[model samples]
Target chain A: DAGITQSPRYKITETGRQVTLMCHQTWSHSYMFWYRQDLGHGLRLIYYSAAADITDKGEVPDGYVVSRSKTENFPLTLESATRSQTSVYFCASSATGTNTEAFFGQGTRLTVV
Target chain B: GESVGLHLPTLSVQEGDNSIINCAYSNSASDYFIWYKQESGKGPQFIIDIRSNMDKRQGQRVTVLLNKTVKHLSLQIAATQPGDSAVYFCAPRQAGFQKLVFGTGTRLLVSP
Candidate 1:
């Protein structure tokens, strides 16, 4: 509705396959981020978009690609899914990049085999 | 290497008892801190937040205490209930960055 949403609540793909996870926010936030959550690692940022057509790498960006064509949509793509890439992915958005609140969507549980 | 960490991985408390979760941060430049509550299979939901300028901030049933000298933060829940059982995470927002470094998280188990 008015908050952020992630597509494909659960996904299972084979190794070497390409898959994309979608995120959309209705709040028109200026910042959107993708994070992967794993045991003992908490949440590691994969990529973040400050605005449309502007993106930057975070702590863990290898093997993952992200693009934001529009302000409301930020999608993460895995060119070649590996077993190590299997983890829960969360998408979040904030109105600004500094000192602002972030709203998260229901996570996407991806399993690569 | 700035990092946020939790003191306990899991905590068990009886219903109606007070619950406390502690977190340690390594960044003195962190100016803002937040606490989130996450249930099984769900994303983290914001609970409370405090700024570096303040030592304590209180909400309905929760309180956040920030000690800048030691770079420590804590979340105290008053009159814990069964619904309070969830994984609690502390995140500190580093100045000049959008990233909010999250803690390892503490699982609170409230037994009724």
Candidate 2:
């Protein structure tokens, strides 16, 4: 009952449609991250937030937007979904920067048709 | 030379046997590393971690070995069980950043 959780564990949308994936953590971790997993690429960070209102782009942030309005919530949005955006999205939270354990949510599988 | 990779993409071992998964990293500046286990349709869970200052770290039935000399890292599971079947990824923590670069991942299949 006290862990990270992602909304709509699965999503399906058509191309050019907007989609938002929600991530929530109960631990109130300061560091929250969004990553996309595709075949051949283990996990690519899309965006991360150090704290409320503080966000930064990761390796592959194009076509994606993220906001951290609260310490427990970080949401990722795809302005316009594309087939390439179809992948498993993972949300993780850490207490600090280095030498900290990251807790992950169940993940959301998005499909863009 | 700051990439993390694995020698094998998949490994199959009989249940109750030991399993060794290998990983190689190129960043000498990376001081921390972690091993994550991800089951199908789920997010990766942290299994174990090790820092550059140490060569080995153990947790429960898992052990992580870090060889900074060759930029290699390994995870060994003793008496592997069916529950251990999952995709294991090795991630090396960047020196001055919170971002972790993950390896391709090794799929471990345990046979009963």
Q: Write the per-residue lDDT of candidate 1 for residues A1-112, one digit (tens) a residue.
A: 6899999999999999999999999999999999899998888889998899999999899999999999999999999999999999999998874567678999999999
Q: Model 2: residues >4 Å from true position, as ranges?
A: none
Q: Cα lDDT for residue A100, model 2? A: 86
What TM-scores does chain A show, candidate by candidate in order? 0.98, 0.97
Where is the poorest 10-residue window by lDDT in model 1 chain A? Answer: A94-103
Clash-forming residue pairs, model 2 = none
Which pairs of residues clash in candidate 1, taking residues 3 or more apart in a chain or in different chains?
none
Q: What share of the true interface contacts does each candidate keep?
A: 0.51, 0.69
Calculate DockQ per candidate and list them: 0.69, 0.76
After superposing candidate 1 on the true structure, give the runs of residues whose Cα lies further than 4 Å from its correct spot.
none
Candidate 2 TM-score over all chains jointly: 0.97
Question: Residue by residue across B1-112, what tens digits does model 1's lDDT show?
Answer: 6788899999999999999999999998899888999899999899998888999999999999989999999999999999999999998988887778887799999999
TM-score of chain B of each: 0.98, 0.97
Best by DockQ: 2
